[model samples]
Target: MSQSTAKAAAADASASAALRARSEVARLISYIVIGSGAAFLSLRASTLPTSRWEPLGAGSFPELVFGVLAVLCLTAAVRAVIDIRKAGGANRLGTSFAKWLVARRYSFALFGLLVVYLALLPLGGFSLTTFVFLLIAQLMIAGISKKTLIQSLIAAMIFSVGLNMLFAEVFNVFLPRGVLFAG
Candidate 1:
């Protein structure tokens, strides 16, 4: 094989090893939870009132969406299970998990930031939350420097506040308002 191809093959082989069992297990668990949640939502959506003029109920779209989501999640769980099996078992899970975390420290940090940003959105409003998230995420990616910080701030403000205004004025779609900010 060519040099790059051989390197890729080696990487793939390493990726397919038992080191990934922990991540696969995590994926499996998340898929199961998401699938169950979607199934529950679908069940709830089925009870929405139907109008006589329309063939479908008001909840029909939601039901279809949630049902599809549940099915997809289940499929993903199956794939995760297959991956877990291929990666061996729980024997090396503990040892390999630390290695995986160390190797993906930056990814995990960004993921954690995303989760926090999402969780805080309702409380902070779309404008403030989006701006903060954009600034921090950009800084994390670009590294901290005075020029980059200012640039990130400006970009974040433009996108966040500008988008909020565009949606409110042009599109007539009002974003979620935070309790902290009284419009």
Candidate 2:
């Protein structure tokens, strides 16, 4: 066999392997449809008790929003299934176990970041915690760049201070201030 032919065969094998690693489209479609139906039913069946603020008695807006989301999810699921069928196994599309594995690989780091940030929040206050979290997040996701590292740290400080003031003063939403301000 010629070198070109061998390279072509190798490429085809790799493509096939990648396709096999992907999730089944039909299963994804079924799950999405069932999940949306359940969400729709739950929202529709939810009862809101009488409250002075709600003249029509709450649960009205939530149910409407949920119904809309259900319709959207259902439509998306149907379209995905149809597209996959049209592709005739040429395209591996849908959220499957393989995709979940890939997503988890990327997202697990976020869980750790959240844990550290929350753990430090009470001890370091919002500014310090925000700075550390933002820096770590930026570095981890994008890799360390001197400019990006400095910018993210500064931006975190600005955002945390501004948002903290806005919530505490303007909205009267008390955020944890730690023991720094107590003394």
Candidate 3:
């Protein structure tokens, strides 16, 4: 083969290898996230209160939902494992995982925001806390723009106050009234 042809072939091989490495890392992260989420949801559903009046009880719907989620998660994990095996099991994942995390820093930032939102909920009240969380999350995910900012504000208001009112009036479910606002 010509020297140029050999160099071109080498470059193509390098690019393909990089792509495969990224795909494997992505699959590993997905498997971990789905598996952990399923476990958490299942445990949370188990803690829900059961009603004596209903055969299935209050916990029934949550349990059913979480059960379905768990099944889907398991299915995805199995598929990932199969794919990994087919790709010769690239098991040296530590460096790739770190690179993936750095590449997707926004995801970790959003997760931190969610944790902060949960922690501040009781102290800030549902309406205020949810409004702020929605606004910030929307901005982070969608990026900043005049139109987006306006829409984000409206959406945040609707989700926070409107949903709260709907739940309290229609469903008769009262959301938490923060310690600051509690009568």
Q: Rank the candidates by lDDT, best first.
A: 1, 3, 2
Candidate 1 regions with alpha-carbon error over 4 angstroms: 1-90
TM-score of 1: 0.54
**What TM-score, over all chains together, does every model reach?**
0.54, 0.47, 0.56
RMSD of each: 6.4, 7.0, 8.0
Over 4 Å off in model 3, which ranges? 1-13, 22-94
lDDT of each: 0.87, 0.70, 0.84
- Model 1 per-residue lDDT tens digits across residues 1-183: 899999999999886664457677766777999999999999999999987998997999999999999999999988887877776765564565577668898898899999998898889999999999999999999999999999999999999999999999999999987778967
lDDT of 1 at 28: 74
Residue-level lDDT of model 3, residues 17-39, one tens digit each, is 76676677677678678777867
Q: What's the C-alpha lDDT at position 156 in model 1?
A: 99
- Candidate 2 — what's its lDDT? 0.70
- Which candidate number would show the highest lDDT if scored against the true structure? 1
Error of 1 at 67 (Å): 15
lDDT value for model 3: 0.84
| Residue 120 Cα positional deviation in candidate 1, in Å, after optimal superposition | 2.3
Candidate closer to the true structure by lDDT (higher is better), 1 or 3: 1
Off by over 4 Å in 2: 1-104, 179-183
